[model samples]
Target: MIRVEHLCKRFGDLMVLKDINAEIRRGQVISIIGPSGTGKSTFLRCLNLLDQPSGGRIEIDGEDILAPKANVPALRRRMGTVFQSFNLFSHLTVLENLTIGPIRLLGKPPAQAATTGLELLRMVGLAEKAHSLPDEISGGQKQRVAIARCLSMEPEIILIDEPISALDPTMVSEVLAVIRRLARQGMTMAIVTHEMEFARDVSTRVFYLDEGLIYEEGPPERIFDHPQRQRDRDFIGKVRSLSYHVTTADYDPYALVGKIEGFCEKHLIPHRIAHAAQLLAEEVLGVLLTPLAPPRAVPTGQIVASSALAGTASTGPPLTVKVTASPAPSGPTHPDIELVLAFSEKQRSLEPRLDGAGPPGNPLETANLPDDFALNLIRHYAADIGYERVGERNRLRMRVQSIAGREAVAPIPLVRQCGAGLGGGHELDSATDGDPTEPDRFGRLARRTPATGMTPHQRLSS
Candidate 1:
């Protein structure tokens, strides 16, 4: 167990940790979360005397570590620290990295240390890499080896400072998975990390620091979802907006929908608008799953007949849909829901040219109409739509009115034409006699079929 009393750390005239007081109990996992340069890592460093505290008392197992007579090295040995950089000796093999500390620092026999090192490597799921050099392993693997080396000392508590921060996007999960396992096995830890979602899911207690002080501290649900402080809310919102990324594969539609659902729920989306927004996402994503027929100048009335019937199971890569909530327009009272769907990079003979879709005018008319199904679906559900080529990906931006603005209309219309009032609601049960494909809960066609039932605009007037 450890305790901090009036903890303070300063570099010259600049204070990094100010009058911080908190307790870390045995077997407890505490996460320190905050923006960069907020003293989160500094607090962790001060705990182990890696950075001497300017003034304050830090007691570990009833001994004040800052005392002149206290054995700082021995006390620190009881706690292990994992840094952002792997910090493994480049010349040492994985097994050597783990064994060297125990043999030299603890004075254990080389044979005993080697056995313990092998066991620690096995615990971190890196037994096979024991012979590999630091440079031979991946960033994630090296981090895992770092954790294993820490365990080789048999420390009572672990200090992890952004253990996954240096890893590639693809390697982060592996290292986190190792840490998560350690937590499950009851390893006491104090982590300073930018992994908010991981901390929310794993931490027993959360310390949200701001300006070198614990601005808010509590359980993850309270800190992450229902923070009592305005700054906390703003921080959480900014983090959420920047951190969300989800990929929806061609055959699996639920992946994207699930992400949207979780995102909307987290943002406290209104019930009426939430349902409509989700429906809009489902319809748009569903249309994207199917392959579009080559573009042609089809008349408005025959649009459904010409393009809607040509969509089939696409063999191309899946779409990646990213949704983020932005501050509402200059005069609007609610947040703006923006959805950006990124298509595959593979060149295709059937791909429609972005410039050839239409001329500038009303979005419903001027919007890209390469695929009638997608065009109609967006026009019916979104207030704005635009398309462009970004690098190797084709990106589409879609926006819709917040639920607060449309809750008065029951069974919200699928499409509200330019300047049209919300009237004649379209029912989900419309009979598509011409096309046998059944509509989903969101009224999206189950398969490539002619748009039979009443047209979105026609239903708006009835």
Candidate 2:
């Protein structure tokens, strides 16, 4: 268990993390996300006092780690960390990577450590790659080796800092799959990532960091759908736009269903979304286009309202292109729904980033939710929103589709139900609301519990 409170870290004049507080429990996988330079790496290091917090309290189990009597190095050994850059020694083989930490740090005999080292290698599926040097393998394989090296230490928690961002698009999924596998094995992890689909699927909880503070934190469903803060919404909107790229800019800016804005710019590496999709579709459809693009645009027949009902407006466009969001519901289970929205370089008065992320006075608050309850929220939303999973076998085949028959569904889309964007995680006991007095999964009553008759929850005898 890790407990951090009022954490603040500053380098020179820049304050990277501010007033951050969170409690991470065992068997939980928490993913942190933010734009570049938002202090994600710093926070990870602070877990083991790698970068001592300027002022904050850190506790491991029940001990005050920041206390003068605590052994920082010992604490670090109890926690393992992996980086995006395969920090594996390029000159050494995979076996050497795992053995080095144990032999050197734990002062174990090389042969004895090798026994454990080989076991660790197999855990990350790299026993065959054991003799291979870092330079001789793929990025994903090298990262696997790095992970094996960390496991050799037998740590309780793993801290991964953007471990897949440096890899190419195809390789990203392979590495994420390995991490997901690790999660299944019940390793507690605190990860910093940009892979929205991966994070959404595997995370026990997610934290959105903004301006050096924890802007929002909750289950994936709450954080993704009923985001409380506008900044948080903008962060996800831009990310989803880039991942999906199919939605139109004028629709709702936040609509994200059809007709992407075509912007011309010299954006380099990690591959541009629009260009990649064009290449992938070239053999079939040449280059995809919409009325939103310039010069050689095609016009639509008649505009349709987003829904047939009245009052609610159609922030979506007419040209409905559909993509399945899947693996027959039996595939890898969690795949990212990537989308990107671009526009003409000359266009103005339209920065779609401001859509759902608009500044508002509301903040979502969801009480304690069971470990896997969020997945239910996702399935509920995905089915109704016309989001069919669209990739191949062992993949998240959910595709981007047109907004023709799509309308926000009920009991989900808490943003529409609440009239305020807030679904921070807990379920509503009644269809209309959730009582604040219920006990959390750990059997502790909420702060609002009444003094009488509520004797925690009872065990269900099967």
Candidate 3:
């Protein structure tokens, strides 16, 4: 029953809500979620004229509330707001807090307001605490009393601004339960909440605000599961990433490893999985990828680091290593890690892909590589691996396994060439040497290759 077009709110030099356009239809529950300082609360306040908009139109049931000579007080009576802090009168009893609004603002008789107030208290499950002072009840009870007070005005729409943010964690569920009941009974609500799961479950529409605008808004599933924008995805914790570029073969692998470790620690990835990620980066960059670089001669007295090779002095195409960690679909404690290696130049002629489709005299077999230590090590720690070519770039993707019990790792499958019409795949045998029982320092089974005269753990260390 409310339509906001090009709504803008500014506090001095700070622009809070900018060009916001949305409509709150009857019985629609729209949840506004975003990082703090994104003006979610300000947008809600502007709806009821608590914060005056700097520009644009706010129409309530065909009446322009922001227009000159508009009945703002009358417009607000049709909407009720529940603030983050419980704004109850400290001296008033719970029933009085609920009845005072309808009696004073709507001019209802004390007897009728009292009857309606107690019914709302009972509806919110605070009937027994009707006579309790505001200070006597817990935070959740006070918020519920505040909600009932809002309903006592008999508002057509409710604007709740982070109602449970100030409450104790144990008390949060109770307040949310009351809001959920109201939503079920077809109450129109615009909730500003940080409770991601609650918003996903209760909201018919979800708005993700960023940079002082509605960045994305859609059904809960689309907004939460498949956010179309990067900021939206990051805000909702769908995926977290760390990226680095390697131009020359002399790029600092240690610095890249440090970044990977920091990202893992920040996201609470398990120690074993984090170590696997580091190992993957080391082997993929130092071993498999370094050989693909165009051969370059080093000057006798010069050393090159990544930072020193920037701008005009850089050579060859850059390889970007992007490590993305996303929550596992199975809801495990560890997130699923995907390591993507994108080569700016296609490597069709540089290195033989693990795609096994080459002739019998392939370079991989003839190069005396000591049983392909790097590839075997990658397969041991990876749940799946694939290769694809996109335009000029050849991308290799690997999904790291959570090696707690070794059950998450699947058998090494055929590496299929995908994207850009590169088809067909070649199957590779499982790299297991029938020694899956030995645990290494990283708490994973040490795969020992007799040809290499070393275990995977020793290979990693060496």
Which predicted model would earn the best TM-score?
Answer: 3
TM-scores of all models? Answer: 0.55, 0.55, 0.63
lDDT digits (tens) for residues 1-462 of candidate 3: 889899999999999998899988999999999989999999998999999999999998899999899988888899999999989999999999988888889999999999999999999899999999999999999999999999999999999999999999999999999999999999999999999999999999999988889999999999988989757866786444566666544667778778777877676666777777777676555333333342233332122222233556435333121111111222112212233322112111111122211113222112222223455566576544555434434445555665653565444322210101011111111324346576422234445576875544233323
Overall lDDT per candidate, in order of appearance: 0.66, 0.58, 0.69
Q: Candidate 2, after superposition: displacement of residue 177 in Å?
A: 1.4
In the range 149-171, model 1's lDDT, one tens digit per residue, is: 99999999999999988989999
Q: Which stretches of candidate 3 lie over 4 Å from their true place?
A: 238-256, 279-462
Off by over 4 Å in 2: 239-462
Candidate 2 lDDT, 56-142, residue by residue in tens: 898999888889999888988989999889798988888998898889899989999898988877877778877888898898888
lDDT of 1: 0.66
Stretch of 10 with least lDDT, candidate 3: 416-425
Clashes within 3 Å, all models in order: 2, 39, 0
